[model samples]
Target: MGNKNTIIWIIVVVIIIILGVVVVGNRKAQAPANVQNQTQEESTAEEESLPNNEVLPIGNNQSEGSANTDTQVSSTAIVTYTDEGFSPSTLEIKLGDSVMFVNESSGGMWVASGPHPTHTLLPSFDQKKTVQTGGTYTYTFTQAGEWPFHNHVKSSEFGKVIVK
Candidate 1:
């Protein structure tokens, strides 16, 4: 029992350290090359000029000269589905933005406002539509709240989108 407890403590500490390193590394990697060497005021100005509340694409996706990604940065926001579940299990978006549910797995998926079968959490948001692999479903979020959703096909996999 004591050995098991010691092992658990060691595992927890290692996980925390790894998470910290990943977070720090991501911050550095996400910053634009032009802004990395700039003064604080310059960085502040750059941020102020960007579109607010929408998640900014990292790296060259933000560059005016780069347009190689299959998905373009448009008014549409994406929530991708995988074999396990949603790629971004939690998302934040501006009110009135469209949320695109892309089914990337071999299995079809159902996205509905939840409490499982009832889906009464946001009744009007309910739908029987199922998107197959490589297919998509989009819903415009006009209401401001944290909307909980799940894959009806795989009920246990769920996520929420907070609209500001």
Candidate 2:
């Protein structure tokens, strides 16, 4: 009887240990998923509050275009997309300025370089070129016109870089 009781006690202890191991393993598996969710939420928040155009300082210890000998310095502008659609959908700049379209969306997007229904600006622009997440496309405008562009993948997302 003593031997039987000892065996039963050992079995119960083993069962408890197995249950503990299963619980710990399940928690370990869930930890990564929880961390991923938190990271995604933080990213979304940051995207919402991001500025429309991030102006980089031109040179060392000098304001933008201050040290340049030529007064006709090129300007850089960044266009970003958000939940409310393209931030600053209408961007005005000089004729010789350049604009950079940065795709921060999780999916693909494109910058159709021209007016809708008659896209004459970028005739060679591939309509199906997919700009995946965290991609950038630069376009220089040397002419004065209203160049309308939109995300071909998502038509509702539209913007224009007006070169004057």
lDDT, candidates in the order shown: 0.80, 0.73
Leading candidate by TM-score: 1
- For model 2, residues 22-104, the per-residue Cα lDDT tens digits are 98888987897788888888877666544322322323325534745233677878888654567679999886677887888
Extract clashing residue pairs from model 1: none
In model 2, the worst 10-residue window by lDDT is 52-61
How many clashing pairs does model 2 include? 0
Report the C-alpha lDDT of model 1 over 14-80, residue by residue, as the tens digit: 9999999999888877675446657567767668756442335544455533543222332568999
Check candidate 2 and list the clashing pairs: none
| Error at 15, model 1, angstroms | 99
Those runs of model 2 whose alpha carbons end farther than 4 Å from true positions after fitting are 1-71, 115-118, 121-128
